[model samples]
Target: MHALSELRQARRFVIKVGSALLVQQGKPRVEWLASLAAEIADLRKASEVIVVSSGAIALGAAKLGLAKGGRGSLADAQAAASVGQVELARLWSDALGHHGITAAQMLVTIGDLEERRRYLNASATLARLLEAGAVPVVNENDSVATEEIRFGDNDRLAARVAQAAGAEAVLLLSDVDGLYDRDPREAGATLIERVEGVTPEVMAMASGASASGLGSGGMLAKLQAARIAERAGIALAIVNGTYVSPIARALDGPVGTLFVPQGDASARKAWLGGRLAPAGVLTVDAGCAVALEKGASLLAAGITEIEGDFARGDLVAIHGPKGERLGQGLVEYTAAECRSIRGLKQDRQADRLGYAPRAAVVHRDHMVRT
Candidate 1:
C-alpha cells in the first residue's frame, strides 16, 4: 500500500537485490529469499521482471570455509563466485519453482554490456525470456571480470541491464531503507523521500560501507546507479529488503528514495552512451570542424581523411586538424565511402559516392562531446 503508484504502471522493471539482503547473521537466509521470490511472482502477474542479484561470492565464501576478513584476494573472490554461482541459481530456481515460475540464469561480464553488438544481443536474449514467460536472473561474470571495469556492485549492473532492456524502472533493494540527508546512523539524519535530480548536495551525503557485510556497495553505489538510470531516462528507487512487497510498493509511491528521469533520450543516444569503444576516427575540414564544434551536423564535404576501417552506423571519433577529438559519433558511411568522398566539395559528394545518407559524416544529434 506504499504510495508508488507510478512505478506499478511500468510494464518492465529491473530489480537488484544486494548480497547483504541474501545473507543475514553470516548465513544464507533461504526463507527471506523464498519470500522475495513470492513477491516477485506476484509482480510478474502485472509486469515483466528481471532480477539482478548479488550473493554468489558471499555464499561461496561461506561454503569455502573462508572466515570473516579472510577473503584472500581477487583470485579468491573469483574462485568463490565460480563455486557459489551454481548454488545461488539453484536456490533461486527452487524458490521460484514454488511459485510456478521458471528463472533463467544470465551471467555476463563488463565486455558483454559495453560492446554495442553484445549489448544488443544481451538485451534481445532477456527480451526473449520475458516474452516466453521466464524471469531472467542476471549477475556479473565475476570469474573473469577485472577490477577496472568490473561492476563491483550489482546496483550499477542492474541499471545498465535496465537501460539495455528498455525497462521503465529499476528497483534497488538493500539493507538500508533509502537515501538520507546524512548518514542514517548519525544522530540527526533524515530520510530523503524523493530525489528529483542527483545534485552535488545529494552526492555530498553519500557514505561508504559501515557494517562488516558481504556486499561491496554502499549508499554511494546506489546513488551512482540512480545517475545511470536517470541518464537512460529510466526511473529509479531505493528501498529496504525487509519490505516483502517492496517492488510493488515502490511502484505505488511508498516511502523510498525515488529518482525521476531528467528527460527521455533517443534509443540511439542510449546506445552511444553505452558504447565501450569507438571504431575509427573522422577528420573534417576547418569549416566543417567549426560547425561541429558549434553543435552543427557533420557533413560529407567536411571530410579530409577517415582513419581505420569502419562501417556505417559504427561509433567513431570525430577529430579536428590538430588531432583534437571534438566528439564521438555514429558514422554515416563506410570507410570506402569516406575514402571516395575525401576532399570532395559539398555539392560533389553525391556524385562521388553515388548517393548520400546525409551531408555530414556524423550528425550533431548522433554525437556526444567527450
Candidate 2:
C-alpha cells in the first residue's frame, strides 16, 4: 500500500481523467479543465505527465441532445464521438493553451496497443511528444471502435498507456474520493486508504455497475485498472476530482485509495506462459534461436516457417531449430503477410508487400520465455 505523497517523487506518471469531471449537461466543464491544465503545467516542471482523458463520447452525446441515462448502444456512442471529437480536442487545446502549454491529441484504438508495430509506433510518438515538452491527451477512438474491439472504458486504456509510456504510476481522478467498504452512496461506508493486497474481498467492494449516469466508468473499472498497473509495476491512485489543483492536493493529503505495484514479474510471466494459448507458430533457424535466447525481436529473416491462421496482434509460439518451444509473443504481421516476408531482409519488407510494415514479426517487449 502506498500514499499519494509517493507520487510526488515519481519522475514519469499518467493521469486518468474520467468523464464525470470533464462533461456537464453535454458540454465541457471549462473551469475544471482550466484548473486541470494548470495542474498539469505545474507538474511538468518536475515530472513528465501523460493524461488519459475520457469525455469525447459524453461531450458528443451532450451536443447531440442525448439522454443522460448512460446506457446507449455502441452505434449511438460512435456517432456522438464522430461529431464531438473535434470539440473535445479544441477545448483541451484551448484550456491547456491558457497556461502556455501545448496539448496533443492521440486517439488510440484497442488494436493500437495489441499490435506490436503500432505499439512501438505509439510509444515512440509519446516519447517524442514528451521530450518536446508537450502533454499528450490520450483518448480512445470511440468513433470507429466496435463493441467487441473497444478498450471498454478509459480506465483500462489509462493503465495500458502507463505501461506503454513506462510511467511510474497512474493517478485516476474520478467523482468519488476513493474506494469504500461498500457503495459510497450507502450509509456508514468508510473509505479504504491504502490497498496492498487485491484480495477477493477488496475486489468485491467495487460494483460492476456504472458509477454515475454521465459516464460508463465505475469502481470495478478502476480496480481492473489497478490490477493492470500492478502487473506493469506501477502504482495507481484513485481520488475525487472536486478540489482545486486536485493532482497537487492528491500528492499531499489522505484523499484517495492507492494501490501499490505488486507481483509484476511473476504475474506477467504467468500470464504469458500459462494463460495464453498460442494462436500461431513460428519456427526459427539455429542462429535466430541463439539470438532469441539473448533477447532479440523475432525478425522475418530468421523465421524458417509459419503455422496457423492467426492475424496480427495474436499471440504466437516461437519454436527453436529442433522444434523446442523457446517463447511466445504477439505477432506483428498476419499469417499471410508472414509467409510473403519469410527469409526477406528487413529493408526489403516494403518491396515485397508494396507497403512497409514493421521489421520485427514479434517485438521483444511483448515476448515471454517459458
Could you report the Cα RMSD, in angstroms, for every candidate shown? 6.0, 8.9
The TM-score of candidate 2 is: 0.74
Stretches off by above 4 angstroms in model 2 are: 68-71, 263-370
**Could you tell me which residue pairs clash in candidate 2?**
26-62
- In model 1, which runs have C-alpha deviations exceeding 4 angstroms? 1-3, 67-71, 210-212, 248-253, 274-370
lDDT of 1 at 182: 87
- 185-248 per-residue lDDT for model 2 (tens digits): 8999999988985666798899877666666778888887887677667889998886768887
The total of clashing pairs for model 2 equals: 1
| Alpha-carbon lDDT, every model | 0.80, 0.82
- Model 1's lDDT to the true fold? 0.80
Strongest candidate by TM-score: 1
The C-alpha TM-scores of every prediction are: 0.76, 0.74
- Top-lDDT candidate index: 2
* TM-score of candidate 1 versus the correct structure, residues matched by position: 0.76
Q: Compared with the true structure, what per-residue lDDT tens digits does model 1 show for residues 193-240?
A: 788878768888998783446778888888878877786789898887
Error of 1 at 362 (Å): 9.3
